[model samples]
Target chain A: MTGLLVGLGRASLSVFERLGRGHLFLLRILLGLAALVRRPRLLVVQVWSVGVQSLLIIVVAGTFVGMVLALQGYNTLITFGAEQSLGVVVAKSLLRELGPVIAALLFAGRAGSALTAEIGFMKATEQLSAMEMMAVDPVRRIVVPRFVAGIISMPLLAAIFTAVGVLGGHFCGVGLLGVDEGAFWSQMQAKVTLLDDVVNGVMIKSLAFGFVVSWIAVFEGYDAVPTSEGVSAATTRTVVHSSLAILALDFILTGLMFN
Target chain B: MKDPRLMEISVGAFVAIGLAALLLLALKVANLAQFSPPPGYEVKAYFDNIGGLQVRSPVKMGGVLVGRITNIGFDSKRFQAVVTLRISQIYNSIPADTAANIYTAGLLGEQYVGLEAGGDDTSLVAGDEITITQSAVVLEKIIQEFLYSKTTKSASPGS
Candidate 1:
């Protein structure tokens, strides 16, 4: 029992140490600089991969979630004869919570995993080493572009998800469930405010998620041990760690901002 | 290697365009006029419960959104929720004796403030407090009350 306790303590300490590393600060600065220096083609590929590629998944998931929210919210309100407030329920839930967080998670799973794998592969192939020998900073060259791309794409994708999700909720709640269309829209217009909550929430979540994803990918790639096996392990760790971190950070930020 | 410089420029342009598009879309959706309530018409209502009542929750009259709940807070003195509503320009003529009720939508939907206009010809001006108010009737409490009443009735045979 004592041995097990010791092992657990050591393991937990290592995890916290990894999380508290200062490299992430440097990585953020490097990413910003690279984004400033690099031009068109890098940007296009980043946009295409991060925004365009992830579009379909975001739309599909957002729509369904919206539908479910409407169905559940509408049913609950109906018993109390407040069916008119369905619009406010749908709008506030989507804009404040679901839209940004869900979209970011989807982006992390899709683009974020791919980024980790690609960078890990380059490390395995010694391309990163070659860049180092050539005096080209690999962090700036490879990691920064992806980082900048993520930050830019996340908010745009979140907005798209929100708009589509609201429409989907409308279709389910009003079209299928027999809610008055005018009442739905009017309540939505009355309830959703831009500056105080919705806009601020979306922006903060997207940017933080982008930063977390890129940092994880680069950290895993840089520290990958061996050649092939190490790279593979790093790739897996990148995906899992970044995804979990996004969720954990989301809760913390939400408490700080909303509660 | 692909030119990092070129990539950066393209990404910057892409982000700029995307932000612009989102701005346009937000403008179209928000329709600025909707945010502006009438120049001189505010009212306060009290409720026992205001479930799911967000800041922008509508104040409706016969299913029309005439105003919005601008603020909600607990009134320690009254031991009720004090809701401040701003009526739009077109809805500036609400009668002084209007009754406000805390209402819910479908089961589990949102809660809102519903207004019933009185027959009085005097229009309510800004800073007026709504005297007639109905607190929300929670479904769970009603169910519990009904069950207790049924048990009590069954136990007593004579009365």
Candidate 2:
């Protein structure tokens, strides 16, 4: 009994310690933002690596998801004689929930894992230490730009995801399914609101998810044990932890905003 | 080193497309234009029971949207519901004796106020009261009335 209690205590203590360290690391990166502003080119380069590279996957996934939503929604709505409302169902779901959440998940897997591996490899090669030896703040020179880039890329990607998804739904709903084209767009416009559903649901949710995912990726990379195996482990952890954070944060955010 | 110009151009393009997507989401998918309240006049109507009628419900004249319900209040003295509608400026010629009736859009759908115009030369202006207003039809009340009428008919036949 004593051994079990000791083990549990140690586990909880480590978790809290990691949480505290993560917050501090995030604060340091945020403080480093001022220095990053002086060299906007650094930000542009990171955005290219993170945002532009991830575009193809976001669009592909968005189209498939939107098409699937329309297909499934049509089947259900038809039973109740509401197939005409397919646009409402599809647009609302994509905008309010699936768009931000799925985009964040994909971002974690794509750009997030890349961030961890790149940073982790730098630590493994003593590149970070060498920067410190050269009188450079590694956090400002390295982590801040990527972190800010992640933050900027997420909302844009999510917005693109939602737009592509809406078109995909339209193709499936109006084109393939033969629902009236006019009704499809009109019902969607009448039902979904700008501030409540679009801004609050999609944009704000993506922004929050962006902050969480980027913070996790950078922190995990910075905290990784400096070895080849350690870099791999950190990369895996970045994807897993970031995915879990996106889902859990989505739930909390939905409760706060929608309620 | 890779071409910096190419990298910057790609990033700029990415940002541009993303902003365009957001703009499309706002204007095309969601109701952005409807957020701005149009130039309109307000009119009040009293009903016995509002039912599921809510503020922002469309007030239609002959199935055409002319205004929207702005506020729903309870009149303590008359024990009635007071619904205020903001009619657009273009629809300023609505007859003074227009009767407002609550109607459901579709089966198990949202309810709105439907106005039937009367043959009056004078038109309703801001703050004018619409006295001829019908309350929303509650499903349970309708079912109960139907059942009561059936029982009464059966009893009369027996007598």
The best candidate by lDDT is: 2
Alpha-carbon deviation at A217 in model 2, angstroms: 0.4
**lDDT computed for candidate 1:** 0.76
lDDT by residue for model 2 (A110-196), tens: 999999999999999999999999999999999999999999999999999999999999999888999889888988997898988
Off by over 4 Å in 2: A1-6
TM-score of chain B only, all predictions?
A: 0.78, 0.94
User: Tens digit of lDDT per residue, candidate 1, span A139-248?
Assistant: 76776677677777888777777777778889999999999998888667655566644566666776787777767766676667747888888778887888798889
Interface DockQ per candidate: 0.19, 0.90
lDDT of each residue in B12-121, candidate 2, tens digit only: 99999999999999999986888677999999999999889987889999999999999999999999999999999999999999999999989967899999999899
**Model 1 bad stretches (over 4 Å):** A1-17, A20-35, A38-41, A72-84, B1-33, B38-159
Worst 10 contiguous positions by lDDT, candidate 1 chain A: A34-43
Give the per-residue Cα lDDT of candidate 2 at B131. 89
